[model samples]
Target: MSDVRTKYKDIIEFYKTKNIAVLMGGLSSEREVSIRSGENVYNALVNLGFKVTKMDVDANIARKLIKDNIDVAVIMLHGKYGEDGVIQGVLELLGIPYTGCDVLTSAIGMNKIITKELLKAKGIPVADYVVLDPSNPDKSFNDILSLGLPVVLKPVDEGSSVGVEIIKEEDQLKGKLRNYLRRHPNSFAEKAIIGTEITIGVIGDQKNITILPIMELRPKKEFYDYEAKYTKGMTDFVIPAEISKEQEEKVIEYTKIAFKTLNCRGVVRFDAIISKDDGLPYFLEVNTIPGMTETSDIPAMAKAAGMSFEEVVLKLLEYVKW
Candidate 1:
């Protein structure tokens, strides 16, 4: 941690005079959510006395970025082109530094199937799952049997809980899969872990990393869908989650390992399912470009860890190296 601070101090001081671009609102299903996060981050950076630009990202983003001479980019974009490493690749080509994971990690982190495979290979506990393409939805059904009923069908590369379904019975499987395919056109199914869902926030690069407090997400309905995730009062967040000390320590430890295994940088949040029976935590997925809204889980976790939202945002900015 001390080494992380020392190695990144030059970048941090350079940020004092840099023109930061807050990228958000790409042409994705999660545009609205990205806009919200972008607004929050833009406002915070402005309050922190940085020269900031709010860019509604699109195909012309590269042109705009080069034209504006963006010293660093604060990526507040979610889903599709934003979180899938497209923008990061663009930044790389344009010779600009940005926050969050690099191209490889960002692309892998957003794809649930890929992320699951990576975690499984690392001996990390993850729920059973199968990938489904538009040409072969029936194959997914076959894979679902092992995972049992009441499984979760979700878009492979989407966030903000878009195109996610919680199928409670085998009878409803076909219809749900058909409907989801009609909308998403490409999706996957995962065995829904019926346990407490928690998110752990981690910061820094490969050389050094720090784990923030754990946040327990309690949804009102069957699962933490889009509505429950974003809608006010639809969910409850318990920071420094009310888990045993051992469980908390294990969660923090696993969170760090997962972040390092993914080769993630900047700030990321890992979602996990803690089984009530044995207290074992299963790694669900990692969000490399997590939401930056004030009410977002990462921010909540940082706050619980004695860091304000502004400080967390600034801390992330400090790590942006070109």
Candidate 2:
């Protein structure tokens, strides 16, 4: 722990005049969530005595960033263009360091199909899934049905559980699937596993990775949907998830592999399902820029690991690279 503190000591001290920026509130379905996250982060930085600017980002973000002369940016945005490498690419070109993955990793991380394919290719366990195109949803039905009933449908390049649904009946599959696809343009289906849903928060980059305590999400609804996520008391979370040591170890192991394989930086949240049958952890997806909201799982896990919310925020800054 002393070594960890010493490693980040210089970075923390450098924030004295660093001209920090908290970029949030983009044009995504998760705009409101982003605003909430942004405010939380902005306040935290102020409380820590950092010179920070809070940005309700827009298409003219480049102009605003140039006007402010942002030294380093902390991304609190979610969904679509915000977390999907657009902002990251812009930051790269501007020669500014930002929290989270590089442009390549950010782009790949946003697309569910691409992320799953890469993870599976690396011998990581992922749930059975089939991609569906909005223009041609007819042919993918059979492939999806093969995965069995009660499948999970999610938008291809979205976050915060936006546009995610479950098809419990075969008859309702085609129409509902079409509507979701039409709305999202690129959505996919995965075989739903009935078991514990856990999210692991991994911090740092490469060799110095630190895995926070595992958080088990139990939504009042069937799954952790957008409503359950943002709405207060809509979900129940169990810290250090009530699993055997072996299961815990497997989750951590897979998390490390997923983080490194995706070339992630800063803090990331890896969501998974511990199968009820074989008790194996199936990698769902990775959030390259995990939320820093008041109720976000990453902060909760950090508290469990004996780190305050302010400390977690500072830790993310330590991993930023231009």
Writing each residue's lDDT as its tens digit, candidate 2 over 192-285 gives 9879899999898887899998999999998898888888898888998988899999888878888889999888899999999999988889
Candidate 2, residue 12: CA error in Å? 2.9
Score each candidate by Cα lDDT: 0.83, 0.86
lDDT tens string, model 1, 67-137? 99998899999988999899999999988899999999999999888888887787778877777766677
Query: Candidate 2 overall Cα lDDT vs. reference?
Result: 0.86
Error of 2 at 294 (Å): 1.9
- Which stretches in model 2 have alpha-carbon errors above 4 Å? 1-9
Residue 257, candidate 1: C-alpha displacement in angstroms:
1.5
| Reference-based TM-score of each model | 0.93, 0.95
lDDT, candidate 2, residue 302? 92
Clashes of 1: 0
